[model samples]
Target: MEKIIIIGAGLVGSLQALYLAKKGHTVEVYERRNDIRKQKLVAGRSINLALSNRGWKALKRVGINTVVEKTAIPMYGRIIHDTEGNTTYQPYGLEKEAIYSVSRGGLNQLLIEEADKLENVSFFFEHRCLDIDVESNTIIFENDTREIEVKGDRIFATDGAFSAIRARLQKRDRFNYQQFYLPHGYKELTIPAGENGSFLIEKNALHIWPRGNYMLIALGNNDGSFTCTLFFPFEGEYSFESLKTEDEIDNFFKNVFPDAYELIPNLSKEYQENPTASLVTVRCEPWNYEDKVLLMGDASHAIVPFYGQGMNSGFEDCSIFDDILEDNNLDFNKAIPEFAKTRKKDADAISELALRNFIEMRDLVADESFLLRKKIEKKIFEKHPNKWMPLYSQVTFSHIPYSEALNNGLKQEKIMDKIMAKPNIESLWDSQEVEDEILSLSANA
Candidate 1:
């Protein structure tokens, strides 16, 4: 069995540790942060992860999904709040299908706890990664005051977007790296539960207040409170910068998001006090180094969170790599390079998709034309469930590869453009003629 050393005890790393330990590997996980179960970590920009099919599948791969289900709150649809206090509902899928809302911190702690239960798995908290000797598969870490070196058969870098491991790899020749930051940033706000721990809004839905250029979203938590986030630009006419004072913040919310404003009692204070976090998309190539070292999760590809797939995709990386290892007869030499070569395109496709989804979520969700197109798409999906599925469903509710989903979405878009161009489409969107046209177009696509 290999002696596997994993960096970063975040969601992905901890789960990975469990998977390897169960396979009889002597797994060691080094985390920069204190153990979450043993510490009181202040709530940060967790933004509440959406546990879709991809994430659930990964959890199930390690035989822990059923346990996780107890803590998750299922959201069947999105509740859209418009500027004038009007609301519209968009179901994410057919009646029974839903995405789950899970606390990032809670889930991370649970995974760590589960992994810790195994005899062969060891967790090193407060152990900061100093550097890596990629040539020898060795790591130098700082624990409190002194530095120590640890050697392993393989090193897995699951450190997040600002991975120290990936930083070292970036200095190597022939390594490709890029980072793109969206003009937008996000801040966490809250809509606390009412008396008796009752939800102030619909508990079974994801809440969205979509403006022309910005949006506010909320998801229900186990404690009945809704964690809300406001996505706005760093600097612009309508951005976080312009709303400098409490009055400006209050007025903006009161005018644009009347319903949500009424629910969030600490609107201005939360706006002024909470931190504004940047949105970044990170990409890198050659995720593995000759079976000695590898990059997983955000270390290799960190996409914007608009698609709610960042965590899901990371979880998927573990499952995919595990499968590759089995397929290659547990040969790291074959598995590492194969996974790196094959999964790169899927990761890049999701990155592109997440960026595009931001436009649809923040702007098009409330647009009349966009709504018509969605209605047409939904009808088509319902009628031809076997032949067609909405892009959102495919990405969120299926195991379809992200690259294939993206290609299918592009073809569907071309068909939609023509179907939307038909005279009086707004009135005849539900007609059989439109369905036939889409079927014919897709056949040729």
Candidate 2:
């Protein structure tokens, strides 16, 4: 068995450990933070993540899906709130398909506990990775008291967006890397459970207040509370910077998200208390360094959370890497390079999709034309299931490669644009003429 060193015990790191340990490798996971399972998670930093099909497929492969599922609250659709305090419901898919909301810290803890149960898996918490020698297969890590060097046959860095390992690799010759930070920043707030622990809003759907420039989203938690995240520009007329005083915060929410403002009693306090965190998109190439080390998850392709696929994509990395290992007969030298080459395009595709979805989520979700497009797309997909799959479904519900999904989605967009341009398209969205046009366009394209 190989001696494998995995860095960063976050979602991807912990899950990767489980996969490697199951393959009979001796795995050591070094985390920079304290063991989350043993500590109280700081309030404002715990962003809830959406666990969709890609994430489930990974956990299911390791037989830990049930445990993770227990903590997830199924969000069937988006419950959109209008400025007038009105509401609209948009189902994510045709059937009862839903994305599960799981707390980031909670999921990480569960995965860590599961990994610990395996004799081959070991975890070292509070061990910050300082640097690495990729050619020598050596890593230097610093704890509270000392810096130590360790050697392993192979190393995997899942250390997240700001990976020290990736940083070190960037200093090397011919390593390609790019990082982009969105002007928008996010802050977490909460809507506590009501009397006797009941949800104040719709429990089974993701709630969104999509203003043109910014938005607020809430996902249900098992504790009968909802974790609400406000995504806004760091500076602007209606940005986080504009809301300085309690009264400004109050007035902003009351005018924009009055209903949510009422539900969150401590809105202003949480606004003041929570730190506004920046959103970054990371893209890099040659994720592996001569079989000595490989970058997985956010370390390789960190993306904005708009697609709700950051964790899902990371989890999928483990699954895809496992397939590469199997295909190459467990040869690291062959599998590592193949994994990087095969996965990079998909990573880039998802990164672009995530950015596009941010616009859909924050602006287009409320637009009448966008809603009409969605309805027409759903109708086309329902009639021609084999021929048409909505881009969202392709990304969220199926394991179709992200590159294919993006290509197909763009094609579908062009087709839909033509269909929507026909006279009286709104009234004829469900007409046979519309279906025939879509089918013909799809076939021709």
Segments of candidate 2 deviating more than 4 angstroms: 41-45
Tens-digit lDDT string for candidate 1 (70-183): 989999999999888888899999888999999898899899999999999999999999899898778999999999899999899999999999999989999999998999
TM-score of predicted structure 2: 0.98
| Candidate 1 residue runs with Cα over 4 Å from true position | 41-46
Worst 10 residues of 2 by lDDT: 39-48
Per-candidate Cα lDDT values, in order, are: 0.91, 0.92
lDDT by residue (tens digit), candidate 2, 1-445: 9999999999999999999999999999999999989977653247788999999999999999999888788999999999999999999997779999888988999999999999999899999999998889999999998999999999999999999999999999899999999999999999988888788899999999999888999998877788999999999898888897999999989988989989988888889988989999999988989878999999999999999999999999999999999999999889888998899999999999999999999999999988999998888788778999999999999999999999999999999899878989879988888889899999998
lDDT of prediction 2: 0.92
